[model samples]
Target chain A: MYQALFFLFAASAVGFAINLLIQRHPIHSALSLIGVMGSLASLYLMLGAEFLAVVQVIVYAGAVMVLFVFVIMLLNADKEEPSDRSKMAKYLGLPLLFLLLAMITVVIYRQFPEDAMVQFGDFPGQTAAIGRLLFRDFLLPFEVISILILIAIIGAIVLAKKEP
Target chain B: MPPAVILFTLVKILLLLVVLLTAVAYAVLFERKVVARMQSRWGPTRVGPHGLLQPLADAVKLLTKEDITPSSAFRFIYTMAPLLSLVFALLAFAVIPFGPPLTLGGVDAFQVADPDIGLLFLFAVSSMGVYGITLAGWSSNSKYSLLGSLRSTAQMISYELAVGLSVIGVLLMTGSLSLRTIVDAQAGTYWGFLPRWHVFPQIVGFFCFYVGAIAETNRLPFDMPEAETELVAGYHTEYSSMKFAMFFMAEYANMVAVSCVATVLFFGGWHGPLFGPPSLQVVLPLFWFALKVFCFLFVYVWLRGTLPRFRYDQLMAFGWKFLMPVALGNVILTSFVIVAWPALSRFWS
Candidate 1:
């Protein structure tokens, strides 16, 4: 049952992505993008990462996608005609995409091992493990990342705010 | 035997589903009544004795209403958005432990689908609900809807950081991410009569989590997405009848989901006054759990009544500046306390 749900979610994700690519209207594309996010969240749940799954839905699918659609709507870009790309650019892009896809497939097939199965285990406790690593072992990096986020936030305020 | 167990599980799930749907229905009525009372009105006093059947009436009204699709909208997406919203909303409750495990037919069964990483699962699915709103707004080709979707997206993303960070403190003290384990860890008392609630030790974290949850749910004061005067019903402006009703259902469902998380994390979920027959232990904990959840839900309605809607910029600033920093500081302070004072840390254990 779980495996089937996983496959269904994955298939829908791919289907949504294709729909996103093929859709003429930007709004339609944005809507399809949401389907992709939803499927990804489902896949996360199936993988036993419930916290991650909910966060994916709340943060990425719920919040981020809303922003994307909101911006698309704000710009009123849906009525705009699809960009007419040069025939040469389309031809070149198709092969590059195909090559990337083929390379990914080859890498997966070649490096595939018998130990691909994911096993869930209790590693003491999640909170304890994260706390121990975050503070004791990875303290400096964690603090540094937070500082980086602080900087980014300050930068965003400065960039977005109008001059008095 | 396997098939029997599966069938039993299905039966339990169906029962829970019925309860949840019923709860969701009444939750709407409750909100209406409370909000009305707050506004100095009689509230829902019709339908079935003091508007008891208001939700059913509303449901009937919604179902019979015309479900219209915009001519220019994406056909598949337009149809799927509400369904996606409702599904994700319902799924988040899967791992929520309504009460302790009950033994029936000599087999112990708890709530449905308690994956090892249950906490993460709730977050993942709950977050996915935004798609439905955004898609509905964008696909409808309405500017107001688009704006509402945008506000919702930004608000959710911004508050999510605070929400995630705030929970880290509880997770730290409890030392577990599983909801069941977290609640069980808090069963005993700390320093006599002061219950082992994380709320006491992690007060700042609790506060941040509470505020962030309200924002995350798009409730009052933080409900910029659906500011009627500003956005004209926000993301679902173009939705009619049942489609619109799905959005409404998702909102309440999200509220319940977050409330459940809060109950488990901050308030000792399924842990309450314990003075009964030893056999009644199982049932009492669940009662306490429901009581705590009801209190949180009441707070949701209360805030909606009392608080004024926040300006968009002010809401963003409050989340990013005030809430996020405090949450981050609490985490750091918690880490410091745990590291610097071994004597103090022993009390937490």
Candidate 2:
């Protein structure tokens, strides 16, 4: 069951990523990105990272992608206008990307044998464990990231504000 | 898990779906009737007795109506939007325990799925509902739909912060993310009379939560996205027939989900007086849970009838400038009180 679920989610994630690249409209691409994020979230759940799965959906798919869609709509973005002289780049890019991905897959496959299997119930991702790690072990980085987010918010407001 | 357990869960899921669909259909009727009475007029009396079968009639009408798609619209996203909305709206209920666990054939059964991160799961699904409205509007290829959908997306995201912060108070008091644990924390009463509900102590949080919920559901006073007078049905301007009904059902479903969450978080969910035989004891808690949910739904309709919609700027200002700060303050105060509760209770005792 675990293996089947993992393969299904992984395949969907890759399909969505490819769809994101091929889609002509920005909104379609954005939608595909959301699909990729969702399938990845399912894969995370299969790996028993339940907290991370929820956070992945809540932050990336829910918040960031909503912002992306909002901007696309607000700006009234239309279907992509095909660029000129892209055949050489396209052909070269695909093969290079495929080779790189295959190399990475082979290296990881060799490093981690088939015995390193993911059993869903073996590692329950309880919130307490995540909380302990976040607050105690990574306290400084957590605080610093929060401060950085605050700075970003302030900067956005300033940038968007109209001159008096 | 055994086959019996699996079958039991399937049965439970079917039952919950039917119950929720029935509730959503009736909620529409309830809103129309209450809002009509508030305006000193009759509503839906032409259907069944006092509009008892109005939802059914409305369903048939919507199903029979032509499903029109605009020529200029993006076909795929427009088609998928309502389904996305309805699915996420209903998915939140999986974690909401309607009543205590029932022992049937030596197996525990109640909620569909009670994960450890139930509260976060609810939040995550609810937040993802933004896509439905936004995509529907954008794909309609209409300016009004675009404006309405954008407003809704912005409104939902802005209020979500307050919603999350307001719930922090309850989470702090309970120190757990599970809805079941939160409900159980408020099990007993105080002074032998008052229920030990979180509302007494977290009154400010409750206010913020309800207000945020109202905004989140895009109801009156915060429903700028679909303000009929201004946006002409908002993001769903181009949707028709069954497609339109999907959006309608999604709205009511979200209302019910938020009401259930409020009941679970503040008013002890299925934790009321339990007495009588074992069968009665099991069912009584469900009654209490339903009563609380009914009150929240009624309040939602009452607010719609009584209040006028807010201006777009006023709504944004309220959510950010006012509600967020207040919710943050409520969280801080709640944390302090929770830390000092023992000492304060000793003095009072």
Best prediction by DockQ:
2
DockQ of each: 0.49, 0.88
lDDT for residue B285 in candidate 2, whole number 0-100? 90
The reply for model 1, stretches above 4 Å from the true place, is: A1-17, A27-70, A79-164, B103-110, B278-280, B343-349
Angstrom error of the Cα, residue B256, model 1: value is 2.1
* Fnat for each predicted structure, in order: 0.81, 0.91
Give per-residue CA lDDT, model 2, range B219-333, as digits (tens): 9878999999999999999999999999999999999999999999999998888889998987899999999999999999999988889999999999999999999999988
TM-score of chain B of 1: 0.95
> Can you give the TM-score per candidate against the true fold?
0.84, 0.95
Per-residue lDDT, model 1, residue A136, is 99
Q: What is the lDDT of residue B156 in candidate 1?
A: 82
lDDT of 2 at B153: 97
Off by over 4 Å in 2: A85-91, A106-114, B105-108, B342-349
Model 1 over residues A76-98: C-alpha lDDT tens digits? 77455767989988889989989
